[model samples]
Target: MYLIAGLQPPMDMRLFLHGFQDFFPSKAWQRTPVLYLPLVAFGRMTPMAWEELDQSLYTLHLPTPVTLRHTGFDVTLKRNRIILEATMEASVIDHLSVKIRNLAQRAGVSATRSLLPSGIPLADITDVDPSVCNLWLATHRHRFASTEEVCEFTVFKTGKNRENTFQEVMSDYQFADLFTPPSELL
Candidate 1:
């Protein structure tokens, strides 16, 4: 696990991405590994924008290549975006869930025994003007409470909308259900 100095609870424990586009890298784009920095320092950092998270934290290098496939999840690349659909097997989910639980424990937060969806989707377009057909980054907030403390997980998604502007797309919550469990199906 990657650890940074001075990173406090909640704020410190987040999945930071770098050199990624629409949850997957393009053929010409080099893959930058995702870092799990649970106890890093965030005092010297400021959030300029969602796409600029690399500026806030120090990146750690691992011995092996880290990808979503390593965690036993299936990733599909579509025409303009990447999709990550979870499997029903508990082992696969536990692989990622364990990391989250460990982070929460280090932060002193009492997290539930379950793993909530924290899938992130990102998009990068180079050929078009962003103002007209821009890519939008959306975040979903999840609040988990126990008898003592409350833990919040902010999941992110990125998409392109031709019909709506960047501001309008960012303000939309119609796709928020993607991160939530389906009551009818469950």
Candidate 2:
């Protein structure tokens, strides 16, 4: 978990029309182990521009700050055996996959491993509607012990009108391996 320093530029629709040219790295980017979250109000002004994303994460809040219960890391240690598993929320499946792909390309793991989103269980999965999808990061072996792996998902919004539920939502951002410890992307 990382602290969101501050959003440099207030969210603007201009970000969508242009690629990542406008996104100057927020102060959060410079921090070590940057799992940095963005300010909630920043997410309200714009929606996720999936097409323009590169090596960063976009975020929004629904009045209520999204709470994350660290179920644990992607690595599991059992009998000196390290097992890696990444489980994503149902709504974030697509974006998470993109980050995984980007990290795979940069990390050179694309060819060796098959990054996939499985276990279609709806329990932990909830519709994060009105709560926009923004926030990116890479999940890779370098972040874990030598014996680990990963799986992921995108949390989705439910069918109910969530306008009243969430106050704001983030647009998007790229999750990267570098965000993982030990500076994997480095």
Candidate 3:
């Protein structure tokens, strides 16, 4: 962070503190593999090189572009009725059913508030599709971008056979201390 901000710590003798836990299964020292490096690698002056031999059981790439089947959306304003819909190869309702009536209300449609549900009720959801996830988020976000400020919703299944979710990234960073690749990966 100091390097990114172009600032140095107050003194060279300063130190940082990380709590110690019994299950912290990472090493204090690890090789700086190109694949193991931090995300700032996006526009690095050089390219990366690697083999699965350096594969990490503990780490993963960030913002991995998970894919979903191609999808489409439906919209209508009939007989003064408003409708919105979408479908996809697979369904995960993380942001599937959002109501834009607030937009209608702002546009002078007062009755829209009572007609639209708090949000759409999703009929189906399966696994998390990274690509689908990205698309759904992008479209819906763009729709509400100007009308709503700071709006987002996320949903996982809430039925039988589900674990309580803290919704956090996994401990992949445990594979090493380095965030970027060694000269090899780069």
Candidate 4:
């Protein structure tokens, strides 16, 4: 199952912190693989006010980017939408669903305070063609020109299935420590 959320600007560290700070103690968790594309592509695909937010927000320094490793899950930014692509594993899908829901809830709270015009929603979950994931992996692999795109690319360590916690799922997928600060600014 794949879950997606359309987000516009003002989407800085605060928004993410609102959604996931409790679960992810550090900014490292935001380092999940991301693909950024024009906002128009997303607005054309969905009925969202993608153009309303300040475009400068996208330029803000986000957390470090994790290299694409052909992991079963991916988070893509097409215009304003954050597309979460994952395999059909129940635990994996469920964990991601909760994450998205948390984001939506937090976004809603912020919206009420007029932090932004509107909040992002957990748009939908659908069955995507396997080729979509394959294409993403292939494109990222080609773009980064890295042959060592495996799940264990990070340095974080974790135990296996300890109390069936979210950390356990992250550990199993080798995503326990997704963020790595770059030694030099590119």
Question: Candidate 2, residues 1-186: lDDT per residue as tens digits?
Answer: 111111111123112212221231342221111121122111111123322222233332111112222231232233433222222223343344454345434533323122333311111112222122122212222221121212211222212221122212222332222123344655
> Where does candidate 3 stray beyond 4 Å?
1-118, 144-186
Q: lDDT score of model 2?
A: 0.24
Instruction: For candidate 4, write residues 1-186 as lDDT tens digits.
Output: 111222211224224323332343233333222221111111111113222222212222323222222223344443443434321112232233233334333433222111110122211112334465455446543221111211221011122311111111111112224355466944
The RMSD (Cα, Å) of candidate 2 is 21.1
Which one wins on TM-score?
1
Query: Considering lDDT, which of the candidate structures 1 and 2 is the better prediction for this target?
Result: 1
Q: Which stretches of candidate 2 lie over 4 Å from their true place?
A: 1-89, 110-114, 120-186
User: TM-score of predicted model 2?
Assistant: 0.19
Candidate 3 structure lDDT: 0.21
Task: Give each model's whole-structure lDDT.
Answer: 0.26, 0.24, 0.21, 0.26
* Residue 55, model 2, lDDT: 24
User: Can you give the TM-score per candidate against the true fold?
Assistant: 0.20, 0.19, 0.15, 0.20
Clashing pairs in 1: 6-41, 7-40, 7-41, 22-122, 121-158
Which regions of candidate 1 deviate over 4 angstroms?
1-63, 69-93, 116-186
Better of 2 and 4 by lDDT: 4
Q: How close to the true structure is residue 67 of candidate 3, measured as C-alpha lDDT?
A: 16
